[model samples]
Target: MNSDAPRPSPRAIASLLVLSCIVGLNTVDRNMLGLLLPQIQQEIHISDMMLGVLMGPAFMIVYSVCSLPIAWLADRTSRRGIIVCGLTFWSLVTAATGFAQNLVQLLAARIGLGMGEASNMAPASALIGDTFGGRYRVLAMAVFAAGGPVAIMICYPIIGRITAEQGWRAAYAFMGLAGLGVATLTLLIVRESRVDPAHGKAGTPVATQAASGIWRATRQVAGTPGFALLCLASVMVSVNFGAMLAWLPSFMVRLRGLDTATTGALLGTYKGLVGVAGSIAGGLIVTGLMRFDQRWLAWAPMLFCLGIIPAELMLLFADAPSWWHIGLAADTLLMSAITPCLFALLLSLLDSGLRATGVALYLLIFNLVGQSIGPLAVGMINDQLSAAWGTAALRSSLLIAPLSAAAGAALLLALAARLDTSQAAPG
Candidate 1:
């Protein structure tokens, strides 16, 4: 934070809370299909490969394509306005999912949901950068990151019961209604910053460069230290995220013979509680440790990625429910803890004006390529092996989860080594 900048005010804290809620809500909509997948598959006869597509490309294609343009608009406009509109639009689209009679309708609704969500993340991240600074900035990002876990913890059990009893459509209806309420709350509570990003504010990029167009901003963001390494590592880590988010609940159902309702209830408590704690812990750890070796920002994630591989394997093959449960909890803790570091590291590297566009670019590739491959490839693997192995095919397919962690660890190692040359601490 610049010494001249005003302290983060009460309203600033309030805005962070609102944005964090939006993050949680966005996560719920994205992961909703995952929890509802088994039911949908039984009713609609979607193959495993199609489940992968619906989870990955069907949603991400639109999200990745739209994010940069919408983020460009956000950087130069009222971020609060865009957020309000996105919330309403996506909430409505989410409600419409309940009405889909076929795969085509569901796909269309997913695409619309993606389009609406594309508007929020980049802009909301930029708002966090604008509203909070220094140590608080990293802490704010942690709060934002925890939103997903918090949402799942609170929502999964209810959604599970709704899906099991009232049907999947009812679960979608409940999520959409809850989202609409949050959107209204956002309009009432959050305030946009007075300093305009476009007018060369104190903490923003140079005006001449800004006037040079998006290409210049692109070049600047691309040139950020560790930007390439961060983007590459982001892709690798996201592979694990996509695979787990899309399939983990289904895996529990298939392997343990737990119903969706029961599975959701267990995972909700397990992943959600541990996840929230880990997210906060990572921020605190990074903030405290970076006061010594600023490279702790890079080091923390690299170590966590390596740790996740073994945990994932234990989760996959171990027969004792208690045994594998430890793996599940460990992977969730390590993965959740590391996620906030990415946001902190990247946000620390970019200028305030460039934050939205830059993060959008990073996320575009992370979701477009890595997330797309994780589910679709795993599903294809499962399909090819299903005849010979039966439910065992899913275990074979999910090895991608651990393999991805190894790959991510390698990429993050390169990032940490590269960061060895820089002396700056991430915010």
Candidate 2:
């Protein structure tokens, strides 16, 4: 830790809390589309493949494309300002989704939502890195990663009940409007940190390196064998995780004959409670293990990825709802453990100056390849198999998730071999 870096203050803690809420809001806005997919499909009269497109590529393409530039701006300027603008923009666009009458309108709204959310992760990750120091850093990141599961927990039941009574549009409107308040709070409370004078000098090697532009930074990061493998592992894990998240509610409703409300309550509780527990536990366990052997960073996620394959398989093939819930909970628990560990590893590989760009590049790959293709692939598979398998098509289509998890486990194991754990600390 830099001796000159200020100790954590109340304002810094409040800023992290605000940032976590922003992350949670982003997750709710993005995942709510998937939660409301069945309703949206009925109203728009779209095919499963089109629903997949709407869920995946519609938002992700814009998000992936815009994230790099927005992240670049954050690396150079005010991250707080970027977040305020993004929060406001996405909130309005999310609310506008309620007014969409057709596929084109919905798609446009989603594109705007994606553009807005593109400002989130990279800048937020950089801010968190700047805010917290060693030892506390991983735990802080775990808390940050908890935002998604926490959002899912809160949104699922509320949105589910609202969709049941009012409509999916109303749910979208309600959540969207609520986000503006968070944005307002963030604007009022969060303050940007001043860069160290030494860090600002162009003559400094770190500054010169980070100033080389996005592609150059990307290439330099990719040049590392371990980091490249970690990215590949991330893509595989995200494909499995993203596909399951997008399709799980519909699968439960259609295949298990559960009501939307039931599906929401069940998943919400599981992700909220179990998921948060797993993230924190995983962060603590990995942080403890890092003191002995930093190789546990990759090994922990590898083990979790392997655990996901069997749990997901059981979830997909099971006949009983209880069995399904159990499988889902187990899967969520294991998968939740991966986020903090993987992010900690990624941050550990980069310097503070390039962390935002590195995170942006990683997110670009994750969204572009994983988020963009995963759901689409599942939907395509479901459509193709429907003629023969009927309702079972969805179940069979989900087999891809477990297979992707297996690949992720393999990739992580490979990544562990290449990483030099002793030198894994941030440059």
Q: Write the per-residue lDDT of candidate 1 for residues 174-216, one digit (tens) a residue.
A: 9999999999999999987733344446555583356246777
For model 2 the local lDDT of residue 17 reads 81
Model 1 residue 132 lDDT? 69
Candidate 2: clashing pairs of residues: none
By lDDT, the best candidate is 1
Per-candidate RMSD, Å: 2.1, 2.2
Off by over 4 Å in 1: 1-7, 194-208, 420-424
Candidate 1 versus the native: TM-score?
0.95
Alpha-carbon RMSD, candidate 1: 2.1
- TM-scores for the candidates: 0.95, 0.95
Model 2 misplaced regions, further than 4 Å: 1-7, 194-205, 208-212
- Rate residue 117 of model 2 by lDDT: 97
